[model samples]
Target chain A: SQTIHQWPATLVQPVGSPLSLECTVEGTSNPNLYWYRQAAGRGLQLLFYSVGIGQISSEVPQNLSASRPQDRQFILSSKKLLLSDSGFYLCAWISGGNTEAFFGQGTRLTVV
Target chain B: AQSVSQHNHHVILSEAASLELGCNYSYGGTVNLFWYVQYPGQHLQLLLKYFSGDPLVKGIKGFEAEFIKSKFSFNLRKPSVQWSDTAEYFCAVELYGGSQGNLIFGKGTKLSVKP
Candidate 1:
């Protein structure tokens, strides 16, 4: 069975502070990873997706960026956070040629 | 660019009430459809999915959705919803054979079933 782990389940940081949210998958290799944000009534929005290491495709332009350092490790980062950057961030992974995606317990970031 | 639209932003229903949540997409070609449920304080769970064949797909917890090609719709339905069914529901779409495999989602519909 595959499992995804997201760190610092909840965080409270002052505005303009640097941010780092990490996600990792176990029991799978070369899996496609994705980052999504869930806001109040806005649903889940795709932020970034990676097919392989060092390959990231951003879905929307925002104050965030993503990186795939390893085959199953994905990190979402922000140099300077904005008030609008506060939301529940989720990490998901799908095996190559697979349709269903598995999600991790999200990180609730509050930019105070 | 592809997108998904869920008709209701919120819905309130009493137990045993028949439930139907409308979902539509803005694409003309082949696509995969999905419905996810997120309970309070929990991660998203796959309620159902539509890949190919059998436009009507059944999912966990007695939930089902019908795919209408002509209308470009995939509406989730339940004969009698339980109070435990209260949760946020999301409709998502992925382009068939899309290289990037980006899954687009709609602004979810929050369902509140009262006992």
Candidate 2:
């Protein structure tokens, strides 16, 4: 079985502070990784997705960026946080040729 | 741009009542469809999926959905809903043969079933 782990279940960050949220998947290789953000009472917005290591496609141009350093490790980062950046961030993984995506426990980020 | 639409933002129903949730997508091509459920304070889980073959797909917990390609709709249904069925349901779509498995999600429908 594959499992996804996301760190810092909740975080409080000051404006203009750097941010890093990590997500790692175990028991799967070369899986498709995605980063999504959900505002309160709103639908999920896809931020970034990667097909392979060092390859990322950004959906919405924002302050956030995503990187897949290894086959199972994905990181979402921002140089400076904005008040609008506060939301629920989720990491998901889907094996190649599979349409169902498995999501990790999301991180609730609050930028004050 | 592809987008998904869920008709109801929130619904309240009594136990044993029939349930129907509408979902529509704007994309003209081969696509994969899915319905995910999120319980209170829980991660999203797949309720059912429609990749190909049968148009009517049955999922866990007696939930079923029919894929009507002509209408670009996939409506979820249940003959009888229980109080435990209270949850947020999300409809998602992914373009087939696309390079990435990017799923476009609809504004989820929050279902509250009364015992």
Candidate 3:
């Protein structure tokens, strides 16, 4: 069975602070990874998707970026946080060929 | 660009009641449809998906959905629902061979079932 793990289930930061969220998948290699944010009363917004290492696609333009340094590791980061950046962050993985994505627990982030 | 719509925003029902949630997509060509569930503290899980086969697909938790091409709807149904079925459900659509083939989710419908 495959499992996805995300760190710091909850976080709080001030505006202008840097941000980093970690996500790792176990039992799957070279999987397509994605980052999503669910805003209040809105649907999940795709922030980033990576097909392979050193490759990333930005779906929405914001103060955020994504990196896949390793095959099963994906990181979402920002040089500075904005209050609008506060939302529930989700990490997902796909089994390579257009498969349904599996999501992680999610991280609740608050920026003030 | 593609988008999804879930007609039900919130629904409240008692155990043993029938369940139905409406989902529709706006895309003319080929696409993949899906329904996902999110429990109180659990991650989102794939309840079911429809790519290119029979229109009706059964998923986990005794849930099933029918894809209607003419109506552009994929509504989920179950004869009876349990209290544990209380969760937020999402509708998604993936445009075939498009960049957004990943997923474009609907706002979501929150279902509350009482025992």
Show pairs that collide, candidate 2.
none
Compute the interface RMSD for each candidate structure.
1.1, 1.0, 1.7
DockQ of 1: 0.79
Q: Per-residue lDDT of B3-85 in model 1, one digit per residue for the tens?
A: 79999999999999999999999998999999999998888989999988999999999999999999999999999999999
The complex in candidate 3 yields a DockQ of 0.64
Model 3, range A1-112, lDDT digits (tens) per residue?
Answer: 8899998799999999999999999997788889999876787889999988998999999999999999899999999999999999999886645468899889999999
Rank by lDDT, descending? 2, 1, 3
Stretches of candidate 3 above 4 Å error? Answer: none
Error of 1 at A47 (Å): 0.5
Worst 10 residues of 3 chain A by lDDT: A92-101
- What TM-score fits each model? 0.98, 0.98, 0.95
Write model 2 residue lDDT over B8-45, tens digit each, in one string. Answer: 99999999999999999999999999999999999999
* Clash pairs, model 1 backbone: none
What is candidate 2's CA lDDT for residue A93?
A: 91
